[model samples]
Target: MTKNISKEIPKEKRFLIMVILLTGVFFTLLNETLLNLAIPVLVNEMDAAPSTVQWVVTGYMLIMGVFIPVSSLMIQWFTTRQLFIGSLVLFSVGSLVSGLAAALPYLFIGRFFQAMGTALLLPLMMHTLLMLYPAKKRGTVMGFIGLVIMVAPAIGPPLSGVILDFLNWRWLFFMMLPLIFLVLISSIFVLDNVTTVTRPKIDIRSILFSIFGFGGIVFGLSFAGDESVSWLNPSVYISLCVGLVCLSGFVWRQLKSVTPMLEMRTFRHPMFSLAALLLFIGMMTQFSTIILLPFLFENALGVSTVAAGLILLPGAIINGAISPFIGRIFDKFGPKILVIPGMILLVIGLQLFIKVNTATSILMFILLYTLVMIAIAMIIMPAQTNGLNQLPAKYYSHGTAIFNTLQQIAGATGIAFYVTMMSVGQNLYPSTSGIIGGAGRYSRCRDTVCF
Candidate 1:
């Protein structure tokens, strides 16, 4: 979309700039899903129940959903340096707190703080990059940023697995401290202070509407599977119902607001909205894979924790390694070439997942999983590039915030759905062999029904 972008950059300075921006994105994206593998370990170590463990993931999503709508306001209020440094500080504090946390509630609080910080990094990095790069190269610049965001989470699970196996669950949070410090130090020198009030005012009512509306939907989706077990649960219905109602109100309020937190009008641009939708889908499947992988390893495949983690490491590394190259492709070929294939590859990867079983070979499993990661790398950056290109320059920051917010929400939805489906299936088919035996069909199912 940035048809006339430039190719000129001093190699040394280019690398430095990229490092600064990528460092920020790496942490943001890592935080998005790094805990995927750690969730199981947390449950085992903390002696927590499934319902309680779900909150570790859900709470992070809740905080992210509630606070993300206000990022535009924060950007408008604070200087770029302040925002960047502030986000790192907040996120780092959260990491430390989570690392030392002895209870689930404290960990949730830590995650909440962590989400607050992560929510800002995405928008600020984009804004910072746009400031540094000339307009001609904005797409190229953002493509790289997108690459960082995409690649980090791709590898996080395997990395988390390895860490959890060798060290402890707390390392996941502790690991981030150094990265946060590096980004903080980098921002001190590399970041520029450029805050302007010309954008829009922070309307309290609009912010509240969006936060509650989005938060409610996320809350409901988070519990949809677990709640389905009890049809008469008022809280379940209340969460879903209130979430829908509030979201509707949020839409109405945004339309009426003179200075809205989100720029809903941008959706009038078809390309922008479609790209956002693709991003939603991309995030949905990506997280679905993330949620399902551990189960495949633990329950279905019977792989040890370390071995399963090792199996995943190659794919993660490859995806992370390939992201920068994918960014460059966006510069050369545009997004359409990359996105369609990426989506197809993603579907192929997920399809491979459907075949997994306890008897499946490890190498084959790794190969299929690696293909999925490749698909993820291919689609994610291109989709981001396409979405950003859809907006005008003035709205880019808010647009990025909105896109990332949708991505986070979509991921939350995907995890919820995947978990819910698994829970439902496990319940519905409990002791399939026994059911077959009772039905006098045990002979028919001896070979095919157990798996």
Candidate 2:
């Protein structure tokens, strides 16, 4: 019989494993948003067409959607060590390929590989935490993990900006090479492999459904910023309808399956559902804000790449610093105490953002933004812990995936929803302002502006 390492996980081993897991999580979180800031750099340096180069971003998102739903199966199918090392290898290889690529398509292909590995890293780490730690300790450990995951993306842009300012955009991929080796070594020593019986059959149909449905949804939302498509257009409406139907079908199928890709029943628990809802809301604002920052910094704010990162650094730093404390507090108190305050801070941050114009100061922006980041970090752990806390130990592997999948969907949806709302606001606000410019017509259309 294999010796159970449950009671014997050394402190050094635990710390090493966490470092390994965080390394993977860091790259995963960093890769998604890092490239947003690098797009202009890539376009200029590589001389790539905009439509074609966009695949780098879109392809990564699509692969993330494709691979995410399968993460739960991977946890059960492969040993923790197997999954951890395998994913790291894939990501490392992808980064190397992208770093060395001579052409755009190859770079995108490399990004797809990177996305494949990244999609599994976070959920798998959460599963590992649950498996490795005792019940009481799991929350604390996960809180720290949550903090790492949250801060990495928040800081990714500024870090990437510094890299791009000093070196070529390829350095973004090259930098990962050394970190990848460090993480690989850590995985070999830190990760534990134990056999479990619950290797549920992979539901290929549900997997395809999730991929197509989510992909369609994201693709449609990606166009929200420009005057690209009208909602009244037949093609737009059809795609939206089909995407909604496919997602509904995926949910319906999950409810009936013996081994569902997502366990809908878990959401039946009130606290779990509420946490999931709040997570959705938080991710919506946080992710959208990250996406918007690069555009704002570059265009409206006129901040240089290195300068923007320097400006953004404090938010990420404060966010990371506050997470462990939030975790400890959540363990002592319930999630509500942290979640409520964190959300209020988030709203304050968002409200402050509305005041940002072409002449805004970086110092003033960062001050408000830091509060948003801290608030988000505060809520993330408690919310994630609260979600996982509702389920039993056996479901930990699957449950973590479900939590992350919810986060992914929420983040994606938040981006889509915010873009759409902004588009609507832009269209309506200008037209209304024009009508108001004409006093005679303005009186007739007064209800339009008020409404």
- Give candidate 2's total backbone clashes: 1
Alpha-carbon RMSD, each predicted model: 4.8, 5.0
Give me the candidate number with maximum TM-score.
2
Candidate 2 clashing pairs, residues 3+ apart or interchain: 158-309
Estimate TM-scores for all models. Answer: 0.84, 0.87
Per-residue lDDT of model 2, residues 347-441, tens digit only: 77767665554455668878977878888877777887887877866566667776777666666666555555544554454533333423322
Distance (Å) between predicted and true CA of 215, model 1?
A: 0.9
Candidate 1, residues 289-377, lDDT tens digits: the string is 65566555654444676566577667767776777777777777788888899888877666655555445687887798789878877
Task: Determine which window of 10 residues in candidate 2 has minimal summed lDDT.
Answer: 442-451
Query: lDDT of all the models against the reference?
Result: 0.70, 0.71
